[model samples]
Target: MTQFDAGTEFDRQVRTLIEKGFGELAGLSADAYADLLAPLRATVTDRAAGMEAPTEGRVPFVLVITRELAPIERAVPLLTLGGRKRKPGIIDRHYAEGDLVRFVPAKEVELPDARAYVLFDVDRGEEFCGAIPNDAMATIAGRGRTPLTMEEGIALVTQYPAALAKNKCFSLGGSRCGDRRVPAIWISENAPKLGWCWAGNPHTWLGMASAADRAGSLG
Candidate 1:
């Protein structure tokens, strides 16, 4: 891994600095380390597709590698994870032992060249388990213990004895409730057309929670 000073601009943008034991890029050759660092050093290119310009108050991102494994050349867009057999976006798609790197996005990153936002590679056995964001947290916490459907999840948040109300929740785009444009919240308690919420990460939870607040006129 590449080495950096404690408080440099580069160090600030790194998420795995602490994890990497003071920002050391372990197990990678010097050339590979440089390849990973190049994107962070370079400016957004003119041909960069779907890249959002840096904005004030926008969440800064960092790259966290799971130690040794490098990403595959053909990166699969996360949205395409679950194919036809399982409805996409309804539930987290199950991955095989060495399928692909399953990562939770920390924020909304549309940039094709977003080297900083690459998730930890599960294929290489990175430790990503433990407290994740609200939605996935809710799901995992309720795994085998509670109802996982959209209706039940909404009830769990909205009705009396609402359990998940405190934590933010979001239904998938084509959710069972039928409205893709509008987001659901505690007050609304509406089941999505697709029947489930899959707010992928913390940043997504923030957006969904805010949208839910607005939709229910809570804000």
Candidate 2:
């Protein structure tokens, strides 16, 4: 029932990840360590707090996945409607392996092949890779104008049952926003309690602990 600051939660997660994964700096002076950590924290904190949704699909969420944990590549069951009969097809979407996935609005697509044809089947309500024989990029544009509210964000996470069922997301409770602690949750894949990571932010870099037990306490 209290307000909460997202940045604080983000800081704690970054610190924990560093400590657990990097261990104590054996040779560095205290000041040196402090110096080293300051920028790391600032860089990560700002990225999470200031993350913007993508501009293209305007997809309301971005799933930031850590590099250490590669996305689980499994085909999701997709029903494609055409030819007077619905056909079952499999589409590839990156699912988090074991780290919290940060959610941002869809701004652009980082396609594996820049020249590949993208397809959007309005009749089927599905988007997938296609052999359209054209270089035009297909996108699900014209959506996600309103900024997401806290409630709406939470709801967005619940929609991905596969991610949640795997315990890929977590919730944080009792963080001071302004004067009170509020309940907060991050439902992105492998999301830590704070829901952002340096591994996946800025650029996909390596060296971060996996999200196996990084759920953190409800506080």
Candidate 3:
């Protein structure tokens, strides 16, 4: 959790003085926090291996990032939870009771119960389509739930709407609707955890979390 003063360089790039929004974390001073974004970017070394960073300079990707209790991205949560059954257009997955799930920085926010979710799986399937669910709609308004690994969460989207069963053609590189690279709902909703500044793509009626915008609201 890094905090940059309003006129600092980081503030110009991020354009939000990140600390201004976090009034709840009064106990922690702004000087003590550091944004993990820079170091996380360094983690990717080989683009040929598919382990690469996004173009727009990691515009704050907030996905569910599910994984087993194991360390790093070794244990795909979905694979461990339910065999990686490659369906035609979706990738179904889950998060067990004690699965180890953590966002990038691991600072604030208590995390949801880590329910079974379904978002476009960027790996085996085509490019992720649809808008990812945002935090406002994804997370419960009041109490926070348990944490889930990224592996387990993607499964739900793979097997969504009972419509996937009808998807005859296998998506080689595009999402279900075709060409919608933006995920309709992303669990990878990265929260600033720097102190409660979470945002993302779209979301469902259940109000899921993501880096995308809001999908369908309860209203």
Candidate 4:
């Protein structure tokens, strides 16, 4: 697989956010938001410099803005199906953002404290397809990888809609609700939908998503 150019990917993410009006949501003008991300560009460039792009598997890195800056409610609606409008991503009515706090990162998955950060070597966990969520989590940990969080999941789909393929969708196993409900992103009504699945259950079409690590400065 050809590796994505880090700088180009970074620029694309910035443009996506601006075009999606994330700056306005953050209470800043588009120009101001771009300016805010300027410093991070240098950091990403430096980190990616001299690194060989992977020939297969995950991309180099993905830029992610936390819920504090880009709320999920707003970000989800921005997602489209195959670059066309189908149905906006919806958070199941049974839960709300306040309940999101209960879903913390799984063990070995450390997130950055900054409002924006980069998720390195993200995998949609295709290998774990057909595996139960609980079992999948163990397998991911055994592989010395970290599962993707809900924010990171949204970030991944936001940047790469192709990742949410029909039969190869993924679950955000990193964010556990202290119950059986594991958050997931899958195709529904020919659109991307954010919903929950029981941890004990398994779906042949869904695997757990993960990443190698994360990095960012406190911005």
Q: What is the lDDT of every predicted structure here?
A: 0.25, 0.24, 0.23, 0.80
Most accurate candidate by TM-score:
4
Total colliding residue pairs, candidate 2: 16
Once all C-alphas are superposed, what RMSD does model 4 give against the true structure? Answer: 2.7
How many collisions per candidate? Answer: 11, 16, 66, 1
Error of 2 at 133 (Å): 23
Provide the global lDDT of candidate 2 against the true structure: 0.24
Q: Model 3's lDDT to the true fold? A: 0.23
Error of model 2, residue 151, in angstroms = 23
Clashing pairs in 4: 1-55
| Model 3 CA deviation exceeding 4 Å by range | 1-69, 77-106, 109-132, 135-139, 143-198, 203-219
lDDT of 1 by residue, 66-99 (tens): 2133232111111111112211122223333433
Q: Model 1: residues >4 Å from true position, as ranges?
A: 1-7, 14-35, 44-58, 63-111, 114-219
Best by lDDT: 4
